[model samples]
Target: MPRQTILGIESSANKVGVGIVTDDELIANTRATFHGAPGEGFRPTEVARHHQKILPELIEAALNQAGISESSDVTAIAYTRGPGMGAPLQAGAVAAQTLALSFGVPLVPVNHCVAHVEMGRSVTKSANPVVLYVSGGNTQILTYARNKYYILGETLDIAVGNCFDRLARVLKLPNEPSPGYSVEQEAKSGTKLFPLSYSVKGMDMSFSGILTQITAQGKKLMNGKDTRWSKADLCMSLQETVFAMLVETTERAISVANLNTVLIVGGVGCNKRLQEMMRIMCAERGAELGATDARYCIDNGAMVAHTAALMYQHGVHINPYSGADYTQRYRTDDVNVVWRNDVLT
Candidate 1:
């Protein structure tokens, strides 16, 4: 199999990532984020259009970075098929399918969330335990059980990143470039004294109220109250509150699921404080945690490639036909990559 090379493309959100893998070595992992959710909130259709506008360039760049002369070197083409924007999924599907058709290789449809799990394993070297996926569109606690991945808890309203961005807007922080990064930087410098409030559900969480509380606090300062809103402090507070909820919820889920190892994925996982919280909690319980290592954290193409490489070993390769479909609402359980290859074949 010539070491089996897998090329992965991820366009599930505001980021466009491309990754390549040869055997266990990660050849290339690249991403381009379209800083779109600062002020204008997220519009799925708009984001999809943005992806469609740049799919070709990203795919080629990744290939070039991997030093591949042609598609023939690619053993499989992997892409995030669903649980993302319809338009963007279509664009990526078209790209993957085109490459598959041209190169005569299998087109592996990967679950975006599961890609996190795979990347987490690559980063942390864990053999499956638990996953905390907190991103712009999703907040979920998942674990593989009964031959299927189960969602232990999730958000009732908005995602964690969405809440952060909303709060950043209220604070009128630097919305340009990376708002999350900006908020974190501001929080490091912030020394204010405004406290945010919120509670975590048994396995679920609510971030909207937290958002409102911080917004109200910021508005009070605008009313000429004698206050010092150190952007860093507020950022620290907000991060503390949200990260605590996630850590508490994750701990509970771990206790109930009887799993110690926890893999934290998504953009929020990029937060050092959140990673530290999870690490400390896991250490207290004698459970290993997978949160650090920039490779798996945040949305990127390498995670996608890493997943394809593993699923290929598990025999999840399925070549799409000429009329194969790209789904918009695909469930994790619906696509059983582990043992579905023979059945479908």
Candidate 2:
């Protein structure tokens, strides 16, 4: 029997990526990102256009890197379907559908959030752990139960990545790689931890208040009028405060679920400070912490392809001829995880 080869496309946000993978090996993963001005965020329309413009090249590059000249070599095509900007999601969906139809292969629609969790699990080999999913568009505590990822808690307002990005913009920080990355770099030089709003209600967390306070402070500092805090100081305080909330909530969730392992996924999961905080919490509780580097944690086609490969092996797929669809409000708990059947040890 021939090994199944899956091609994945991801354009849920500013990055457009393509990946090729076999059952147990990653062949190629390529991406193109759109960067806006330092103080401006990417608009949906512009991001969609960027994906559309660069997707073909990314696909070709991925296939070439994988040493597959014919599209027929691909067993399936998978793409991110929802819980992202609608226009960007549509760009990827349309490309996936077109590729699937042309190649005469199955098309799989993967939930972005589920892809992140599955990728983290695959990378860390974490078995039956409570998940802390954090990114630009989402923040949630999840655990698997009865073939579904149940959400234990989530953000009440803005996501942690968004909060970081907003603060970066206010301070006119470079958005070259990402605003969050820039903030993290600056935070390393911080000497003082300023007091900031920290809101964690029960299991749920909120970052809007912190963002608002930090944004105001950042603006004043950027205008060269405020001497109360340095850029590094502000960045460090923001991370310390928000990461504490996340750590506290995750600790509570782990305690309530009685789980011994905690897995962190999504774009913001790449942060060293956040990982350090989570590590401390897990260590204190005698639990283990699992996380992947940016290659797997950040939004990329590899994760989508990897998750789709798992689903395909389990006979989960859709018709290629049907209309490709996507949604901006797809929740993480909406996916019925048929591929996972692990028993907690």
Candidate 3:
């Protein structure tokens, strides 16, 4: 078969990313993130504007890095198609549509969640693994079956990353690189693990209570009234408490599915502590663990491009003029896994 090249654009949230990929190589992967003020979270409108302002440059840079001089060099243009903020998702879709039209190529819409999973598989070379997808917007345990990713468990209220971000705000952590990163850094120095609420109903988890407790504790710490726990200790306790819940749920899913591989993806997957905890759990079960660094763990276009290339290869694509639109609440299980032929082990 001839080689195919795909250009992927991702603006599902605060980051705008562009990636170029061929059948055998990742030609380019570039991105820019919009950092909100300290203690302030990103709004959809502001994030969309940031993506719009930076997308063109990122696209050009990606293409240049791949040594492609014209849009025609790309076989297809793929963009994140949803389960994200409406405005940010639209920003990427518009760019993708324009690129497809300008290049006279097919336009592919990729599920943001599926992209993360595929990227994890690609990077880790895991054939068929149970997925632990934890990000700012999502937290789910999934396994592939019958041409779909089945959700074994998920967050009932707020996601794990959101929990960290909220606590980061309460602690007034910097949001420059990321709130989660800052929280992770602080957690490394934490020596005490306060008793926080652990709410796990069946396979679903709840983090709102934990966030609330930490927020109240954070206020007291900031006021120099809570000498029992420092900021680092709070961060540490949160990580320990939440990560334990995730590990417990993931282990259950792995056993239920009888899968030997566990792949962790998403922004929070970049946390070394989380990775360590997951690693220990997988090891205890005699299962292998797969994960990617921040570049692929966070929202990025390489995963999208790589996934799109797989979809395109499997005859999954739409005409550029089909008036393709993004869906804000697209679920991970909503996608048909047409590109994957593997079954659960």
> For residues 200-283, could you state the per-residue lDDT of candidate 2 as single tens digits?
999999888888899888888988888779999999999999999999999999998999999999989999999999999999
TM-score of each: 0.88, 0.98, 0.98
lDDT, candidate 1, at 173: 66
Candidate 3: regions farther than 4 A off: 343-345
- Candidate 2's TM-score reads 0.98
Residue 69 miss distance in model 2 (angstroms): 1.3
Candidate that beats the other on TM-score, 1 or 2, i.e. the better one: 2
Taking the tens digit of each residue's C-alpha lDDT, what string does model 1 give over 131-226?
Answer: 898877778898775556678898888888887787677666665555676777777765554677767878999988888877676666556563
Clashing pairs in 1: 186-231, 186-232, 187-232, 190-230, 190-232, 190-233, 191-230
Error of 1 at 149 (Å): 2.0
Cα RMSD for candidates in order: 3.8, 1.1, 1.1
* Candidate 2 lDDT (Cα, 0 to 1): 0.92
lDDT of 3 at 77: 95
Local error of candidate 1 at 52, Å?
A: 2.9
